[model samples]
Target: MGREKRIEYEGAIYHVISKTVSSENAFMEEKDYRHFIKLTCDAFSKYQAMLLSFALMKNHYHLLIKTEKANLSQIMHEINSKYAHYFNSAHIRKGHLFQDRYRSYLITNDEYFINAFVYINLNPLEAQLVEQLEDYKWCSCRYFEDKDNAPRCLNFKEIHNLSGIEIARITQFIMSKVSESKKYGREIKEHNSEENIKKIREISAEIQNKYGSIVKNRELKYLLVYALCSKKFKLVDISFALKMSYATIRRIKNKVEKRMTSDAMVTEWLSEIGKVNAFDYQNDHKVPGTL
Candidate 1:
């Protein structure tokens, strides 16, 4: 039978678990664990995902997440695939590290939510790997025990929303659940923002260097807009960065997305462009003597 469909929706929360394919420890050492954590952080940044809690076990791991967009597949794919790459290269092994597709349970109620959250944190203690949750270095339990030590990847806003007098009370609740087997768990526009614009300018400069000159300013604009969007930057940020009007930025983004998705000519042209150094082509403008 085909794989089951995931229940997906904007603002949907899920408890995601995945294990190594062979029962071998995917995280073989401290560095391996830290590397995976780094990749996890990168996924958070790229996807704008909210990571409420997580635990990294020897052969398996768990994550409690709420996505701002309906993009669980994309988020998980990036995290798993990227981590797999790093794991393989570091271990000098070749093959699937994770077991079959990740298993995720949708959290539709507070009961399940609390259960998953506590369950994940208690994984180490349940496994007898550590006597106290605070001693486990990889899982997020330490951060919950001490907020100052929490990494940037943790989403405290949601944690603070818990129905408790203070964070300490919430931690106590999570700890109680853990005793029961564990508990639950941007860039700107170019000008006004130097960072994104710097990226855009770099791409523009490379294209110019490759093609000798940008045939039209619109081509330059399209490239800048496309680069910004690819970074998942906001349209408003793109507009401010490039000093373009919001409508113009939106138009470029929409046109680029439309053409790239539907127009064979545009797709082939982009592929060809990527092969060589990035270069600008006039918008709807033929190359020299083509028209």
Candidate 2:
């Protein structure tokens, strides 16, 4: 199947995710992260997009943005391409730096928008990269606590106006315990149900049975990981089910996601698996490419 067309419109809000190839570090050091932030500031200024929230992870980064015009594709292309060029040149590497084109999910409602904002802020915490959200210097979450020091890339005033909530309230939501905050999102709530678990298991088994003979063990594992994640199962849930560490599961998922974009065979296998039992592959409430 061909790539899905992005939904673009004036004043559209999006939850965007971009990952590096093979789960490599996108930011190798503090300077690298700072440089990426500089690029982001430039991109926002050039494109007239409002950067509401962001989190830079080891291998991936998330952005919650609102575009003034129907040009999200152009904005992201410039940011990713320019950053990729810089990263490759600085690191003295060749070939694609990013896994694929960034994935974006349209934010349609205030509640969902708030959820995405909190979700982006909580990424570092969820990955166990920081003991506290404040410790993660790469994320915009810290700026919320100290707006006076926030960089030009973020627009706190516009965020407040668009979200219709005070910054304090949004910060409170983000600072809530993971268990409580996880309950607010529709995707998380649905994935917690017994029915979703059953479907995920069914899908995993079908993929194994269909492709176990031809694919290598590693490849098959990634296929199962992709199936579970695409169905909205949390990384923790998948870790337990697959008997792998959380980090490993996440890496496998990223690998599969990258392959799906470039490899026709991988795409065909996943597309066939999605057909089994007539499973509902379309997750309307999910912010694609999120944790």
Candidate 3:
């Protein structure tokens, strides 16, 4: 079969969804969900992708983002690939961890953006998991209230700007949506309930038990993300592409870099990870991980 045509969405708004492979639970606990947020907060910056809003549910995640030159494919790959690696080690499972390709819907209309935003935000309420949207501790519903940011990552300013609403108004809008909410998408509820959260704790504990032994390097993880997003490279060439210290990469992955013998299969994998050609001078001047 021919490859499906990718939707052209450069500098356009999109609603992206990624789910767990085998239709099982992806986020097993509150911290798992927090990791999802932290991952995106880091991933988005490195990719130059912009997040408008995002809502994390039990089995899947919703991301509303804008890409200038980079495509949705690369962003999701960075997320799914790294998260899968972490999840596999944590769960002691192997093979593909996420469903084939994440779903991306172009936000061509204003109503749909609002609908998507509301739909994602109301995930907990729709599932009857909570009486108030703010009650869902994993979401960013409370961020606008300036009370505290939910565990998940969200770039809330764009949606607020587009709606011409201030933070105060945004908080009011969220509360109003919750007040008028019904059974729409109520299926997002956490099922198999208590066992699920406990199971997550067990899995996380196992991973933590092995984390010191697993010895992941932060720089290597960064390199993998960078290499996964890069199109051309021999091992030496990729090695040269780094301005960051290899020791740092090794420290990041907590492992030595492996030798690549040109398996010929990496090209397609890299191709799936789209690239961005744009340059930002301001960013170039900034130090790594420094705001």
Measured by lDDT, the strongest candidate is 2
**Lowest lDDT block of 10, candidate 1:** 183-192
Q: lDDT of each model, Cα atoms only?
A: 0.68, 0.74, 0.55
TM-score of 1: 0.60
For TM-score, the strongest prediction is 2
The residue-by-residue lDDT of candidate 2 on 1-291, one tens digit each, is: 986446577898888888888999889889888888889889889989999999999898999899999899888888888898998899998788787777676665566677778888888888889887778888988877887877787998888897787886776667764554465444743333223334455666655565562135666667667877886776665664455787897888888877767777887656555665526554222111211
Steric overlap count per candidate = 15, 0, 15
RMSD of 3: 20.2
Those runs of model 3 whose alpha carbons end farther than 4 Å from true positions after fitting are 147-153, 175-291
Q: What value does the lDDT take at residue 186 in candidate 1?
A: 8
